[model samples]
Target chain A: MSAANPGATSPQTVHVPLGDRSYDISIGNGNLAEVGRWVTSLRKVTHVVLISDGNVAKYYQQPVEDAIAAEGIRVTSLGVPAGEQSKSVPTAQSLWEAALADRVDRKSTVVALGGGVVGDLAGFVAATMTRGLDFFQIPTSLLAQVDSSVGGKVGINLPSAKNIVGAFWQPKGVLIDTAVLKTLPRREYLSGLAEVIKYGVILDADFFAYLEANVQPMLNRDPAVLQKIIARSCELKAQVVAEDETETTGLRAILNYGHTFCHALETVSGYGEYLHGEAVSVGMLCASRLGEKLGVFDAESTQRQAKLLSALELPVATPKLSETAILSAMQRDKKVEHGKLRFIVPHAIGKVVLTPDVPSEMALAAWREGIEDESA
Target chain B: MSAANPGATSPQTVHVPLGDRSYDISIGNGNLAEVGRWVTSLRKVTHVVLISDGNVAKYYQQPVEDAIAAEGIRVTSLGVPAGEQSKSVPTAQSLWEAALADRVDRKSTVVALGGGVVGDLAGFVAATMTRGLDFFQIPTSLLAQVDSSVGGKVGINLPSAKNIVGAFWQPKGVLIDTAVLKTLPRREYLSGLAEVIKYGVILDADFFAYLEANVQPMLNRDPAVLQKIIARSCELKAQVVAEDETETTGLRAILNYGHTFCHALETVSGYGEYLHGEAVSVGMLCASRLGEKLGVFDAESTQRQAKLLSALELPVATPKLSETAILSAMQRDKKVEHGKLRFIVPHAIGKVVLTPDVPSEMALAAWREGIEDESA
Candidate 1:
């Protein structure tokens, strides 16, 4: 295992090696200052369509624009509301109009300058507008920097289902400035840790152990620990995305280990009630039960996850949904194929796999057991 | 050149051949009857989402659903308004919600059963829902059958831009039923012939000569003439899409020979006011003028286009857009990379080339000439 040396004088960078879609994620305090020339090109960019929500736009928008414009490239900033609800068709339409009003020509690059909601919605608009245009990501929040901004899984939500309308469009580049973490609320910052922890469990055992050892420092946003954590998590995500950009194969499903439960939790809770990472934190606890039921995980493994989530003050159990409702939501999940309830479950610490046909009776028992647990 | 034997005992099938994205356009009569069994698997398909517009659905919904259901696939039909207004986000959202209410799962397929408006919106929904699901096209109108349905160009119109929001999602297979053309309004039917003429002018000279000779029969929607026209047009579009699905290289730009003007016209006239093919017919005339100004085409070729559009009863002159307004709209065109205006102009009959750097002054002059002619 090649552990990224955050101690190296060179800043740690996670390469999102997607051939034509590939980009690099640089982590550390001063990474934001390097944005001027790190972006794809200075010559071709006639304009930069900076798409951010009102919140993040207020803080980081000026610095990001100044860095890009320092190269003599024009910048047009577009801001929308800051929330999950902002990820809608109307919002996308408004952004489309804004892009036009800004004279965002085909040569113009769209910059998603906020959190997950902004990244997904803006990337989607960039993908569809003019049948696939390029966009860059400058994710502001922990969740955005570690998860949404790196993967290129851009989409908007439909009224009936979450993320029910979108495309698998990628970004040209992603710029992660850990220094920006200073502005995130404590709860929002902790929510982002759930995904970073997920990468450790799914792909790298050592990375998982490192996260276990450094959880407190990470929460404190220590620049050294934060850079290592963000860079490794991005590398893990980028590897999974490279193996399967379209999610046609099961390799990509592993990335959704906690997502099936998380989606149902979000859907039932009303999206805004829970941050995506919080839902996943709860969903991970449920998945642990299913793994135990299937004999793939032991009690100690479940306890480790519960302890980790609890230590981080993240939700560890399903909240307020009947077993039937969870099952129904799973049926509508994008991953469900041919009427089967499929799930991405971890077999043990640092090892994940997809189970397409878990016996329904077993699944029900697992859900019942998970929801009932005091830790859950 | 593979000559399509128009008078053969069985209609000669022209394969669009888009590598991994390619599907056959069965131009023979009675293809619709075989659709249920061949395109969609009766055993695996639990439900069918049949999406059409109110106008087309009124006439063909029951029969199409009945036929698919008879093959053991459950069917749920959804209808929207027939015009370009239905291509908005609101209409797409309604249909997306309906699909969820109808319990559309991954195994289920959406069958786009109308003209370009229905096909584009439904196909866009299918592309985004669940990251992408399978869809089949049963194009009832000539424009869809000949052009939009064959290539995987599915999308919706933004209020500020036409077809500005969309994805390149291919259908599982396209079913062209020549039988449905009998009920089409005369203007709409002839409007479709413009796209047919475009394919000939852009790719196949013989196809152009054929349209010239058989104008009367085609205008009457002769089954034999219609099938030949649709097959040839699909072949041209399919070939272009196959080579350049992303449109990064110059190959796919040739498909937009007249679309630069057409999109501007659609925007200036308000999308619903002009059928896409109707705009293209006029746009083609404007493109011919640009070609002449650039010295790629002669006055004789321009006159020939004017004559053919007149014979088809299609508008040849530009609409009421002033030269400056038209130039501004053209600048907004998705095709313009950087501030330079790029155009796909016909070099001569049956040969079009995409020029990436059309001189702005010359393009403005051509726009001026077009506006003057329209006013005259």
Candidate 2:
């Protein structure tokens, strides 16, 4: 009932202003039990279709169900297998059918209580069920808390593409309990920190410096430090999302800072080869090198990110995948326009730009440079 | 190319005013050939995914593809089997895969070329594909032009429920060519008039009287009369839609004047037993009778709707089905809030109300009264 860490920072609320679709991200420590009141405070609900994955459900499902049920709201707990594979059409269909079988009505709300995959899949289910249900997110993973939960982009993947089917369905509110990250597997927890670092590099120099200063605390999952980073990440993302909720304005693309290389690496290497943030760690370096190649960024700035990511135990060296495959995937990326390579290139540690029309050779050079010298 | 009916009233436009989502419904007598210009006039497009059913594709696909191609835009024409069966998950998946295979980018538009099924299915595809697509509707059926095409309610059906998964994805523009109805199957064409008449009954006394006076012209598919009725119906529905784009406000509920009973009838009789409009015809009578039973409407008004629907050649008599099945289906209708039955009861022509807590026995009695007596 009380903060797990006596000196933990007070809970913070980041308001994402999207007019009628606007919602607050409530970041706190040891607040998972408060989900019932948290959801009811935002919207009246008679039923909740609580969706999580096996990994998350094993630990948090019962608590969330009991909490929401204590509020006299009916809870229909549905689980999918953990990992990216769960974000598929079949999983989504099963969830929708299960919810319907449980008698979900228009008045019901969908509560997503897990990492990015669960959040995206459940959010997608909420978006389409009965033409959309009121959605609340209780993000258990740091990556989801900092990134996916703040934006309204929810979707499932097709065999040919990831997130090929989806919508911009904003939740009624987001409830983030940083304490949940305590149970995250080490690699997964550290993988999430890559995005936390991304918010700093893309938009906030001061936040970047803060992450640098607290690398040790971040590695240890210190409650106070975790709360600060997660809240700031949500705030930064919420600001960008409020302005370009649907990615229509091009303003939001800046958030994809290292994603161009990251997506190619993910695609060509085959997804699940590297966790998203691990790839992002390598991708950010490639993007920075590309920025250097384009003469807009300095080598020393790239070195700073490499050092921080290395210290945090993330994959800094790009895996040795086929350069041709990477290039083709980059060309096919959503960020590309008219067969031209586009990337969010960093200009400094804190600022990034959406640069267009970069040549394939130069992008390849960026990728080739990140190849670890295994023989050396 | 000029219109087929040279004296057909000049093309009219009904502007659905929904802030930035606002779009024009272009009502013309033979503008199908002008689709390229019409689409280009609305939004710039490099590629278009033209979706239709086998029946509709045979008639309009080539012309539509050529017309859009003539505008220097690429077209990916995809078709599904005609009828309600096409509005399913498999059909939608095929469309999505085919569109992706043909290289549908975010800039690509989805143009639905057919009846209500294609509009709803394609719109649902357009809604989910790439998080959303700029959609254009070329409604080839009167049911589509006057009803489904205007509301922005697009989705496919689940085996368990019709339209259980979907979105309110507004099209960038709607192109209605009344001349296409000339090739529509006789029964399907007559079934469409049922909704046309319902629009008159629910919204405008003058419109209802216009329908009454023009029943013969309607039967003949008079271009001028078709233009007028279609435009007025679009205007009325558009006005309601603009007021309640997502059906959150109860104002949109009035648009469902006969849908509760209609859905029940369709369910108990099994889908494909009644064209949507045919079901609406019978359901509207049941609702009108229910209104009379509750003392809010008179028998004369009920008879008036029956006369118009019958004159338009739509089925008006309720079929013999299990009373328990019919009542259960009604209870399970989306219109029902909680366990209570809600009916859009008509007090007079052009004036229906969302009446709640209507006794199930009385609703059953209303259905029983509509049955034709073999002895008589």
Candidate 3:
């Protein structure tokens, strides 16, 4: 999976139709070069505030600032420490002050120029900076480019939980250049593949079959496969968002097929041990096992999923979390309604349902199946 | 202006019909007692995370919690230190953790029981907690009851600015009990009168006249007059909200008759020294003055506003901020567009327009009139 692969070339353009919240998710070669024109068309922006993490800022900040400035807008690039820890209230407060000091007024457009963590933090900041402002997403990581950038789920993590403080703020536009994938660590790219696999399992069985067959190519970062997967994933998410913009209906829950368990694992493991995609990889296995146990899915389905994830070199089993800890973590999941566990379990590949009440015993059984229980 | 005063005794209710975003603001005696029933009827709520600040919690927490519990719904009260300082991302993060720890699920309701600060913070948490959940308001102060509770404008403030992190999250219900106003400090009570005055000046000149003629009686805490004023203000705000739920239309801009200048002043002043209403009182004067300078408003109109504010014991002139500082602050205001200053200036009482390209000199003159040279 080398960046030199011809298919690894960047995308030309992609569209995300979310009704009034619709935005374009353009990927391809040198997409970053067109950020100024893209952002200007989306927002009546003059002053630009480019928010990036420290590491990415060191590399891409100069070019991004220059691009936006070339449009005759003053650019203030704010660099925060990169990692999960940066997505906190204190960091958001600091960014708020930095923007104030830089005089990034309401007319200024906020450009999040990093991975998922930066996108979430900066998007949340822009969403609430002045009761909301236009934000553009230049997702630098596979996870952010394919997933977070599309759904408008911007938030910061809490010490006790992940993404406990946030909002459903849509971005003005998302600029994805596969060229950035060249800079991402291998482990991070694999983690992102987990989300790509998730869209297949939850929405399109044919897509799932495509993923199963092309797992090797995807792992190798074949540009054609990668671009197709990213586009399909984003399209699926955008369709869901258009139907249920605020997540009121059941349409949006399908997008959270593995997120219920994934978020719990992310929070309990302290957020940094495993990236979001890794957690989702493990979470999907648990959800599949749960579905099988509840008679909603067959055992063959679980094996097929395990084979696909294993091929991607993604985790197919839960981590070494205790049942009680996992239960406690799951209890903190945002999906719980009236203290009853709600799981987005698959009825079949390409189809999912949000169960308001997943039987406690079945959930425990699946958790135990995926994890070793020292208690029982 | 005693509670028994003829003008302050009768109950009034204002309806904010926003389709799925609709809610009612009930102003009168025993409204608090009916909260459990009203909210219960609106949603399948079984538990409530009641959030309040120290001041209101001290006097009303136990009673409110008990009443909600009496309705057979579980209630968990979380109290924070009372003040504008509490409207921070950190405080909101803490609340999210507390809600998680208390087993607050999606079906559980969050009841905000305090003033504008508490309402804004609590409502924002509910808006994002689990990607938003049901929330109700038990506004205890004059300002919150008449203004914050009805509009569904919930959020927290950044150190650099007020209400910098928040959302336009509508509540399931807003229960305004005039009985709770009895416990508010006299200064806070007077501060609320400022917002009530804004509603009149923006939408109902007749209400403005009513306020002018009965300012003292209302400030004296006469429940009848207060009820009338609160209901009228809620009705005016509700109509605007119905017309423009997300503030995208010019209809909602009318609601910011004084807020463009008010938010700038609040942001520059650090949100500590001035109550929101106090800043708004001064801001209205600034806007009127700016209008007069631009020949949109007559000099006599500005003078009349100053005299009316003075009669109500509200600040009629801006604070001692510098012209440059105030100008910078206005640039950060949410109303600005694409690097241009936009002001919702009134041509006359009850008639406001959102003008996007106000002359810089007129704006500067307005700022100069509102500031002291040394304050810069």
Question: DockQ winner among the candidates?
Answer: 2
Tens-digit lDDT track for model 3 on B126-160? 98886677888888888888778766788876665
True interface contacts reproduced, per candidate: 0.80, 0.80, 0.76
Per-residue lDDT over B51-141 for candidate 1, one digit per residue giving the tens place of the 0 to 100 score: 9888898888887888888888888888898887889978888888888888876667888989988999999988887677888888988
Clashing pairs in 2: none
Prediction RMSDs, each to the true structure: 4.1, 2.5, 4.9
Instruction: List the global CA lDDT of all models.
Output: 0.79, 0.90, 0.80
Shift of residue A80 alpha carbon in model 1, Å: 2.5
Q: Scored by Cα lDDT, where does model 2 land?
A: 0.90
Model 1, C-alpha of A61: deviation from truth (Å)? 1.2
Model 2, range A1-376, lDDT digits (tens) per residue?
Answer: 2133354567888899999888898888878989999888888888999999889999999999999999999999999999888988888888888998898877889999899999999999999998989999999988888888888999988888888899999999999888899889999999999999999999999898888888888898888889888888888988898888898899999999999899999998987899999999999999999999999999999998999999999999988888889998898888888789989999888789999999999999999899899466
* Tens digit per residue, CA lDDT, model 2, B311-330: 88888899988999999999
Q: How does model 3 fare in lDDT? A: 0.80
Native-referenced TM-scores of chain A, all candidate models:
0.93, 0.97, 0.91
